[model samples]
Target: MTDSSNRRRLRVGGLPQVLLQWGFGGLAALVLFLMMLLTFVDVIGRYLLNAPVTGSFEIIELMVAALVFCALPLVTAREEHVTVDLFSHLLSARTEQTRAVVVGLLNAIILTAMAV
Candidate 1:
């Protein structure tokens, strides 16, 4: 628990990583903004004009998926995923380390398969 360790790391992946994260992060933000706008328009049209936006549901569905994917890199880079450590007290340190390695391998395999 040194002061240096407590500080944030520059592992944001240098220039390339920074560009990538900014790009994807911006895209995710744009998609989210569009979704909000779409929802607002749809609501206004549905309630005030008596005409809902056409294909709004489908558009929102697709946008939701895109948003998730666009934000994936950031999530992976920051390791901001959910953790359910229900049995953490029962597991030894080595066991926890082993489980992490196994999960990482499985994740890599799955992601590779999906990419292909």
Candidate 2:
């Protein structure tokens, strides 16, 4: 690829980028690990002690939300998320740009609504 093309690529280079990736990825990993541990303890409590962890479901739910949020930064930085390119093959270059903007706006709106 040309220099311009390389420049246009994701700006995920250098030490800061590495730190950003590690920070978010580590946070997500920690959350996942904690969730697993919680499940293990909950199971032990249920069988061995005949008592389950109180509010385990609520804790898991909150952890899941945290897991998703923590993963978002890493996903956006790496652009590793899945894409719907099925429609891209059918559109022209100019139309593709417009479609991308419209879809991005729609996505932002939907995500905002969901966040609220």
lDDT of each: 0.81, 0.81
Candidate 2 residue-wise lDDT at 22: 78
Q: Over the stretch 33-96, how does candidate 2's per-residue lDDT look in tens digits?
A: 9999999999999999999999999999999999988887576555455886877898999999
Could you give me the TM-score of model 1 versus the true structure? 0.81
Q: Where is model 1 poorest over a 10-residue stretch in terms of lDDT?
A: 1-10
Candidate 1 lDDT tens digits, 1-116: 34453224325356777778789999999999999999999999999999999999999999998997898667666656577889987999999999888877886787667567
TM-score of 2: 0.74
- Model 1 misplaced regions, further than 4 Å: 1-8, 112-116
